[model samples]
Target: MTSSPPGLDLDALRKHLDDALPGLVAGPLDAAVIAGGRSNLTYTVTDGATTWVVRRPPLGHVLATAHDMGREHRVMAALRGTAVPVPAMVHLCSDPDVLGAPFYVMEHVDGAVLRDPESLRALGPERVRNLAFRLMDTLAALHAVDPAGVGLSDFGRPDGFNARQVSRWRRQLDGSRSRELPGIDALHERLAATAPELSAASIVHGDFRLDNTVIDTGRGDRVAAVLDWEMSTLGDPLADLGLYVVYLGTPMPAARGSHDPVTTVPGHPATGELISFYAEKSGRDVGGLGWYTAMSAFKLAVILEGVHYRYTQGKTVGAGFDTIGARVQPLVDRGLAALPREKG
Candidate 1:
């Protein structure tokens, strides 16, 4: 008898797959949870020889609008032949009865998620430098993709996206405010007052960072796939750039473990270099990057605050979220500081 995993009902899943797509799984399945806390719950399942990954919403108190597996699966499927490297989507199940929530399956791509500076340092400065530039280049490629060409013309409303993002985040913050966060509102107001003119609407990976991507260390250290697309939409491409820049400079919290701050690492190009490189590569003027950067900061602060709220409610799984809230104020401050200079 094959026992179910902590977060998955193996028997039901196997049965569902067998009925949906026969001969996919030969026999029983073994499953284990992948440690990505405070968001979606990921599982690795194997049926003797074949391995696959499954993504679902958190255990309880999920924000329905935020964790849409169908949306993630659709974007990955749409970018199948594009420059953006995404996992091979296998199947999508929307019937909540199957595994208690909607879930999707994809081929498990083997790679490392370089989280902290120490891990990046071990790979040496040369590799880190290459990875950083590659990261920028990848974003450029994504921005350059034609939505209509890729069957994603209606994926999101690009018109007034910046304003919508600002309003959307404000509502999210209000819903998740467990404690007082000084200057958060002021930062939001400032960002709203000076939102930049929207660039061409492109697929924005709401959270694009080094850690969110999987790097294949052996295959010339290239990005294997871009994961976690729950916040993705058709928006100003610079919004993605702004968030990436904030992640580059924000200090990793002690309680909530940090990924290698690749931008700070030696040989890795400075934030300015990245911005310029992206501008040159994409042919998009980035004079208003400072505003976007401030918006990014505000956006991230709201996200972390939500995570902290979930943590307080005992709704979060895994570690790192204990001190996640502690990082919110600093992010708010950083966003405010970025407003005047508007520099990346």
Candidate 2:
């Protein structure tokens, strides 16, 4: 059989389990590849007794400076008691001798990720509206959690986090390997010059989006868990909301390179609506958002360009991604200037 992606070798995996479990018998492990995730290999593993999800680094050489499996595990561990719903982390293996790299096991979170507007339309406007509101509320809860209260003082840097972020993503764009995107570089500079002062320090989900969440249809389409934590950090919580809006507002038609398979809503709810929703739930001041939204666009350009870089280097997982890469830059440019200064 073709080599299973990075972390799912069933035959050899059984050999390692004997030692980790000690007399616990794990029968032939069945692995189903969960596609669409960019950084690591996610496998749905079913051992006769229990089901688990294994997350590990991708098979190739990644920037050693980034992709810390240990950090991800630690953050997940710290989020145990908070309002944010997450798949419980189970075990962590850092020894390369065993899994060839660091990996972690987390409770399997079941749900569907919707991306297509048509599918969303099929779900009907009321359901679409409900999902949108729930998404906002769930994020509000995540951003509202106090870092110190959750035992996450070591989680990130709170001081000068806003200015530092501009510098950080700029470096990411510089390191990316690919075609120069439409307005990526210019937008970066603009965002850097116009970076807004953060109101308070709180947990930030660096990359929050529909696909990064598990939507439990059974709970009236409620979000069950926020899945990816590799990018979670401590910063202005408003940035997380800004990122959510950017992900929802991106021009989907061009980004998909074809009809998007997952249902997605458009025009991203006005920043005011989400701001109001979050304020009602968190009782926090969110006076600044326009600039954060601009920053969101800048970061997205770098991120999408990174994807484009990978696609150009032939590392993308699906068809038509190369074209999608081409489309990302324009949105980056538009989003870079989408917002205007809010009335003071």
Best by lDDT: 1
Superposed on all Cα atoms, the candidates' RMSDs to the truth, in angstroms, are 2.6, 3.6
In TM-score terms, which candidate is top?
1
TM-score of 2: 0.86
lDDT string, candidate 1, 219-255, tens digits: 9999999988989889899999999999989754321
lDDT of each: 0.85, 0.70
Per-residue lDDT for 212 in model 1? Answer: 81
Global lDDT of model 1: 0.85
- Candidate 2 lDDT tens digits, 164-224: 8888888887788456566666676667777777678878878887777788876788888
**Which regions in candidate 2 have their CA more than 4 angstroms from the true location?**
1-3, 23-25, 251-271, 318-320, 339-344
